[model samples]
Target: MIAAEQVRAFRGMTRAGTRSVLIYRGDLFTGAVTLVIQVVLAIAVWRIVYSGRPPVNGVDGTTAVAYAAIAVCLQSALLPWQFSSLPMRIRTGQIATDLTRPLGLMWQALGQNLGVLLARLPLGAIGLAAAGLLGALLLPPGLSALLLAVIATVAGAMIAMLCNLIVSMVAFWTLEISGPLIVYRFGSSFLSGSLIPLWFMPDWLRASIEWLPFQAQVYTPVSIYLGQTRGAEAVALVGVQLLWLVVLTLLLQAVWARARHKVVVQGG
Candidate 1:
């Protein structure tokens, strides 16, 4: 059974998150506008790549658009804007107060982050759906494929949060994490196939990247969504995601414990 104090802590965290959302009203609008620009850019790229050829690597214009649209949507939904702020909080001793709360600090952070994602889901979905429709002839995934994609995407988001937490914990030791965090974000974007589909890459390169944790972020779910993997292959990919999630979660827990021990409350 859940403790009442934990419940109250979660509620407090949720309220703080809701207030933060209200404060950043512009982000909601800006995020929507950004989604539009991304879709247009994706469409443009699709046209350029398929200008002469009817299809690229067995993927036609429709499949390309769907692929791009879903990629944009997933990135928007999963990317955390507070990765940088986390280190700052730790450095400033703000995390000290957070740690004092009844709930686990990392769990509270995850709840707040999830709240933000939930807030953006409606707009993100609408923007992606509209873009998909406008692009026309999107390749439709079967119901089972869609279900698996959803599961993978959720797992991917959890993995991303764990990674951010682990990276942010560096503030306890290094006092600066921005450089490493930026590198991590760039590496994830490129290696995870967020910038380009893994299917478009050469077989050997794809095989090597598939084993990396970055693929859990973007490529795995997108592959499922695009119907690029199915049946046993899809199951295997999801298993990989779950395995990574567990590993990352445990790793982050260890880091959080060490960081908490090293935390120096500058004031109070």
Candidate 2:
């Protein structure tokens, strides 16, 4: 039961979030530079791995390189290093401010994230273009594949946002979340196949990741775009993304319910 007033409030918060991020041109510049560096390094590593070598396990050098470029770019866009603000607010006794808002605390946070996401979208596009210029990116096999990839990418971003939101709530109890945030960021990156495609993983490792939400984050859409996954399997992967979306949403609600009453402020 969403009211129109809340929708308007969310929109206003989103705009504020976007303006806050966009006003910092230096941050955008730094992010773009970092994304470029990452793509370059990823391309270099894969090229060296496959230099003078035939396709390993049905994946050629070109395909592998392309995967790395796209994966890195998407990872940069979708998983930009953002810490949970909840921890900082709790530590500074600012959680009280958010608690007084007319909009629910979680909804306000989500609105802010949605705005940040809008701002970051162009960064991802720029990375893709850079990959194209470097000869590391490839178009999807066909229009249908491209469309499906788009859908999966959106779902992936939402899945990722929900996962982060849930994790960020841990600050409510711990009061300091830096350690957990760092661990979760890198752990999710690897598990999400944003660094290495699951195609390259051992069978057992792949089997385990298949059931986790991380795979749906970066791997599924990119793999579909590469056409390495097609037909029913591709559809199945997107289905899994939707399933994870629902599951993570429920899990986030459960976490937030507990966190609301557990706020721990420091230096009060």
**Best lDDT among the predictions, by candidate number:** 2
lDDT of 1 by residue, 163-241 (tens): 7667777777887877887787777777888788888899999999988888888888888877877899999999999
Once fitted onto the true fold, the runs of candidate 1 whose alpha carbons sit more than 4 angstroms away are 1-4, 83-85, 136-139, 264-268
Task: Write down the TM-score of every candidate.
Answer: 0.88, 0.94
Alpha carbon lDDT of residue 162, candidate 2?
A: 86
lDDT, candidate 1, residue 16?
67
- Range of the 10 consecutive residues with the lowest summed lDDT in candidate 2: 259-268
lDDT of 2 by residue, 1-268 (tens): 5598888989987887677678999999999888888888899999999999999989999999999999888777666677235567767888788888789888887777778788888888888888888899877899999999999999998888888888878877787787888898899999999888998999999999998999998999999999999989999999999999899888988887777656542323
> Candidate 1, after superposition: displacement of residue 255 in Å?
1.2
